[model samples]
Target: MTAMHRMTLAELVGGLSAGDFSSSELTRHFLDRIAAHDAQLNSFITVTEEAAMAAARKADEARAAGNAGPLAGIPLAQKDIFNTKGVRTSCGSRMLDNYIAPYDARVIEGFNDAGAVMLGKTNMDEFAMGSSNETSWYGAVKNPWDTERVPGGSSGGSAAAVAARLAPAATGTDTGGSIRQPAALCGITGLKPTYGRVSRWGMIAFASSLDQAGPMAPSAEDCALLLQAMAGFDERDSTCMNEPVDDYSAGLTQPIDGLKIGLPKEYFTEGLDSAVEARVREALKHYESLGAELVEITLPNSHLSAPAYYVVAPAECSSNLSRFDGVRFGHRCDNPKDLEDMYCRSRGEGFGDEVKRRILVGAYALSAGYYDAYYLKAQQIRRLISNDFAEAFKQVDVIMGPTTPTPAFRLGEKADDPISMYLSDIYTIAVNLAGLPGMSVPVGTVDDLPVGLHIVGNYWSEARLLNIAHRLQMDTDWHKQIPEAFA
Candidate 1:
């Protein structure tokens, strides 16, 4: 890897501050890397070269004028789910392939306000629907470590780009492990903040209740920096919490002595790969060595998470996506016989298979006669899952587990099996249900694939989680390990 590519986000910030390289030079280095290698990984759908150069020059000028912020001059990729004015925010589907956002998502505005340069829009699952990135119309995002294997999705492209050093950091949204699962599989760090801790305005909705945008980066410290800028209340989103934001980077080095770590019994049962289990256990032992107490806990309703998520998420997705009917500005059919024909043909032609499947399932669950039996029941079950986390947290400060049941699986391995694919987010969905903050920290490798030590904290406990993760990272080099091919 080139010197610029090898530098972590934290190091880059210091380099920029010290005038080691101009922002234009730094942006060019990363843009060059993306141009050289992204064709192989298919990580980005758009690379704003001219815009990036212009922004970098402005950042350089701002720094020279002593008006630089922590993130100024930093270049990061954005998940296409967020709207960027004048840029096509496709959300990895052809339905909005030509749609140019007229305004920026709150997250995009935050980054721009911090003077961070936008590298490009990264790819994702179509409308953020699939567990693997294969559902993206741009094609699958290959895991940088093993190109034949899949990078976990729907934030696969963001994870891959960061993992391969294409960008120091990127934005990602997690609705049932899109951020953490991909970060775990890609050997990077990803944080899913408490629901409403970050604004959802202008972010393309998949499951409104479950989707929350956060950061993906090479290390917890880097994520801390990114999340600092991304997390805050916005009046534009009614669901956003009106709480004060924490200085995540400030607490990264805090001691974890006397910290309580809960290990949920339900997360360690059958179907978990043996290698992944071993690595997770090893990390738990390491935590014990660091003077943290580990207490066995129970989230008994964990098994119900995947099933409940499928019901509730799709139900919300069906409703949120209904606005995309051809009558408005998305993809539309030509030469329609009538309004009904236009609506039918336009939707049928625009949506991908996964998107269609979820929409149908959702519509069925929310249908008149079946509403109580499916959608209502799933919401009740969601309450049970949330209750389970509440009970567990009553006795522990944070919960720890394997982020996913396995390491990155090969591309197409579970493509034909939708049920199997859904199980990939089993360990992660409960956190979203509970509206709590969770993160993935690289702990070790399983059969050459990375494994993450999943950490879930109570609501609004992002600072504590970041500190815990940062402490662990200081003692291990797993987070610093780079893919050999990229290195």
Candidate 2:
């Protein structure tokens, strides 16, 4: 039998249903794994052992009564960005370090209703600001592959937890490549569903228009299972679409024989690491061998994505974060001279440097005089980038590219250089700007570190994207490889 800790989410589900192992035993196996290995990875921010055990026991009882839900008894990790009722819902910042959520986010509610057990809250970048997990207030999460290297951000902790098998799968939110970037670095499967596909009522807002919750796991099948539970429309989140949720797992085995893959010339340009590009191209070749056609496409405004995102995201962030002032929830300053001082000191003391930088940039961009030149111009550029994808989709079923320019880098390597760190998400941000679904799957390794092949699909095409990724996994073993230390 496969070791409980090493099994994928789907396998665990089957094990539970077949009575191969009790949910309590499975939960304990993962909790033990987290205790034994997480010291080196810093993947988890909180461990809800008591709550998890109770849930697992209840799941076992429900199954005994023949009333088990689809994902009954499965243990999963939730990114701290999601508000879990009675749990510390810190978005990896001191400001909300003491804030306990009074209600669960829509995503959390979905998982709970599906009979999933929460292992704990995973760490993340402070307010989901930085590309590298270094911006996390709790400390940077280490890659399971190499302890000295980063596990990408702001969903780094979730990616590391799954890669290390601390949890079978974990929830992640991608505002601008947060899920996919870390998944690529950690060698796992991650999906950034179309904006509003998954409700964001309680997920901490970074860029309201771009933030999305998705799944991160070992295989596309596991992601399919998780996404089935996560996707739906909620009236609470106005931005959430009323579109019907598809059976994400049902289409995993669908044939993608005549699939048209778009190879963006812009993605193959300078600044891309040679080895990373090689792996992506090799993956493209594998798809070609599978009878999928590759076509050349262009996203001319892609070069402007970074610049535009910098303006638009921060502007939205500035507005969203304003509610964190001292008088309300989150960190409050002690010994304030006045109301103004309290507000200033609480925010200044609570926010990390990266968060502060973005807030300043956002405030400046949206300020009276600069609004037209910066914010508005960025919006226009964003529309052009979106239109680029709209036009390209007319010729292609999915867009293929490198998820990141390079594999994981040393932890402190880019900490001092924000610009370089921000560029880590260069290949991923445009998808968010265009409100499309994107995912990353492990194709191969470069220098013992994993590289991911990025797949972008038109809006609401998550089912096809999952099918394409699952087909590749069926024909390859990259997604099955685990880090040596963890293995």
User: What is every candidate's alpha-carbon RMSD to the true fold?
Assistant: 1.0, 0.7
> Model 2: runs farther than 4 Å from truth?
none
Off by over 4 Å in 1: none
TM-score of each model, paired residue for residue = 0.99, 0.99
Q: Tell how far residue 120 is off in model 2, in angstroms.
A: 0.3
Residue pairs with backbone atoms closer than 3 Å in model 1 (clashes): none
Error of 1 at 459 (Å): 0.1
